[model samples]
Target: MADYADITYAVAERIATVTLNRPEARNGYTIRMADELGDAMDRADRDEEVRVVVLTGAGRDFSVGADLSQGGFDFDPESGPDAAWQEPAGRCSKRIFTMHKPVIAALRGAAVGGGITITLSCDYRLAAEDARFGFVFTRRGIYPEGASAWFLPRLVGMGTALDWMISGRLVDAAEALSAGLVHRLYPADTVLEEAYALAREIIATTAPVSVAVTRQLLYRMASAPSPFPVHELDSRLIGGLGKSSDAVEGVVSFLQKRPPEFTMRVDRDLPDYLPWLHDSI
Candidate 1:
């Protein structure tokens, strides 16, 4: 795995753990850190041995937001750069969206500002009972990045999203669960363990091809309008992948009551539509 002061990655038991390593700053993310995370997540997605990826942060929080004090903060909020701040952050989010494997956010403690947005991007989210989440962009005299402006309202509703964004209130785990912000809330110490256990259960069942196709379809439907072209793309992907050796092995393993060895890898480059320009839209 690529090494960075901000992040660490390791694969074990068909699972990849991507940990935000900067605890002293409360795991605050910078452009460079997000870029590294995007690379790490891409590596995990391409590795066939990795069936699941889990994201977590060290110290008392998942993330605090941008690290302004950290020198070389490449993403400028005031002056426009080549890409929006959402570009690097969305790279990590879109990887989780399109990856053929499962990605879970094992959130503990505070998930504030961009941190909450990152959690929204994951396939599954589980938070500690004591975890806190907030959308503080309005308070910061800025708009939401990391696609939160688009995603939050969908996950919750327009009203809740507006209230959170406008009020800049910190939401607790129970409120977040009620608002559809997270799937489950466990004890603080057990959040990571529970997330891993859930991943294991999913790994034990389901075909890799099926999961990938379903993920693609869901992301398309949620993010884009449906049309003949979209359906055609879906049909082609599903049909092409269904005939692969890995797909066959998946079925055969089910019949034989054994574990499947998924052999497919991401041989294609991600499209330009990805890492989408947030403000451009």
Candidate 2:
């Protein structure tokens, strides 16, 4: 519902779509865009009516990375005090990681550097047939930003992540899919449609709070040394949910062989343990 210069935000049918709106520079990423994206994501996460979010670009490209219109000086971190510096793309990616709503990236064209890194936190990436991707930091004589060193390896495995990040090569849609960078490939025009369809499907069938908790657990437990921690967290979440109104409806609907009308609001109904509260840096 808020206005953004570099992106558009809309919510319909419980889905909030955050679109990168800078098309002129192949939808180049910018500091303003990243701030806007993080703000939009926070809005979506707090809105109980929103169950899913779809991230995409407004024009031909998703993003070719940060706008360097001013010159390469923008990449000079030493020019600014380290404490005052914030990687714009990293802020957005962190927001995605923390959001309760599932986030899906819909890529149509070039997604390189900040473009690709920004999407690493998305639950899934659906790209178009003509999409081109890269992690070109090495080629630019810079290291990866946006905490991509952590996200990239997790999503695509260390070997593949190293190859992609170290090589700094441009990859086509096929290679992206083969390398697990994206989950599905579709025609450019249909990528958004598919993303919307997927969102609707999830909204219709799943309990919102359950989905939120499950997403958190999966992401948090990935680096867990053993299943014991997960088991403990799972027990607390599941045990609490079993007594919920939504759970009752879920069971009743199943017995009656009908669709469930889930009523749990994420803001009001999410378990206390599921939240990972923190102070801002």
Candidate 3:
């Protein structure tokens, strides 16, 4: 089973749990997994039944970064077609940042290199006390890929970022917590349960629209300056849903102290490149 597809996504009770399913190779990411992941995010974001997403690994290690057997991802002096080939795999990790639904990374084991970038994109990062995070790009003679170069410094200060990237060291869960890389830590056996418990708590109180809007706002804030025209986008996003039955139910449910029968379908109009739009302009 560990040698099966590298990714798996399933939705149940309004939550989607996406597993990095490859365990034998320590769940290392392959180009094929990247392609599958891109499609999975699109499906989750569009599915009305899914309110939250959890990312985890199936085995002892979360991921050991890029899979080397399938042609190792190494830097090449020539930057042309080779760059395009490399871009797709990197984009797989970036999709986590762009996806609108709330994501939680439930870490239980080794999260290294590109794996660390995937963990960072998640809204809430929960790790097992024994889990270790390694920044191995420098050790492998490659610069960080998959948005880590930009995301790491923001999560941890520039100095800490440099320490991790330059020194190529592995930080355990406690250090990751102190460094601001992880939000909470649990014993290894209970980490997944705690992650689900946390997700359930959010589901209980958060309005779907508010959660989606807040996620969108955070993505924009992370990528650009404040007063970031997000309000305009927010209004547009809400306006499209204003007439939905879920909107009416949501407003009435709040007044009546009843659970909202949220039926608003995810708008297909949401741009795929929302996070990069500001930079593009």
Candidate 4:
């Protein structure tokens, strides 16, 4: 709902579409754009009316990475080591990482460096057949931002992440799909619609609270040291299901052969006992 200069945020039919709006520059990533994207994603996460988020760009390209037209980043050395600092791309990626609502990235054309890293935290990445991805940090003589080293290996594999990041080669849509970097590829014009269709499917059949919990659970527990902790958490969640209205409705609707109309809202219904809700990951 807030006015954003770098990105456009709109909500309809329980889907929040957050768009990178600077098509003239290929939606070049900038500090202002990062801040605006973080704000927009946070807004969508908190709004109870929003069930899913679809992230895309305005024109042919998603983004060409950090804007260098002004001679790269403006770093203030005078701020010293004590200053609170976070990389521009990390600002957006970290927010998406913690969001309860499912975030789907619909990418087209170039999604390189910061552009591609920013979407690494999204739950699903749907790309256009023309989409191209590259880490390119090593080529630029810069380190990776957006905690990409942590998220990328999980999405793809360690070998793939190492190869891509180290080589800084552009990956095409088919290779990206084979490497599990993206969920599916579509024509450039239809990628966004495909993302929306997926969003609508989730909205129609899934309980918001369940989706929220499950989303976080998978992200938090996937790399867990042992299954015991996960088992314990699963037990707690299952034990509480008897009192869940959504659980009851899920069963009843299925029995009646009807579409479920789940009433549990993510903002209000997420369990307080969820460890990741309070713990920083």
lDDT of each: 0.78, 0.88, 0.77, 0.92
| lDDT of model number 4 | 0.92
> Looking at candidate 4, what is the lDDT of residue 28?
94
Candidate 3: tens digits of C-alpha lDDT, residues 66-102: 8878775444536535533555446765787777678
Task: Give me the overall lDDT of model 3.
Answer: 0.77
Alpha-carbon runs more than 4 Å astray in model 1: 72-80, 83-88, 223-281
Could you say which candidate leads in lDDT?
Answer: 4
* lDDT for each residue of candidate 4 in 1-281, tens digit (9 for 90 to 100): 36988799999999999999999999999888988998898898889999999999999999999997744555655664345667889889989999999999999999999999999999999999989999999999999988999999999999999999999999999999999999999999999999999999999999999988998999889988999999999999999998899999999999999999898887778889999878864
Give residue 18's error in model 1 in angstroms: 0.3
Rank ordering of all candidates by lDDT, starting from the highest:
4, 2, 1, 3
Which stretches of candidate 4 lie above 4 Å from their native place? 70-74, 78-82
lDDT tens digits, residues 181-264, model 1?
999999999999999998898887765556665665666565555576676666665566545777688778989988876665
For model 2, which pairs clash?
none
TM-score, model 2 to reference:
0.94
Residue 242 C-alpha lDDT in model 4: 88
- Considering every candidate listed, which one attains the maximal TM-score? 4
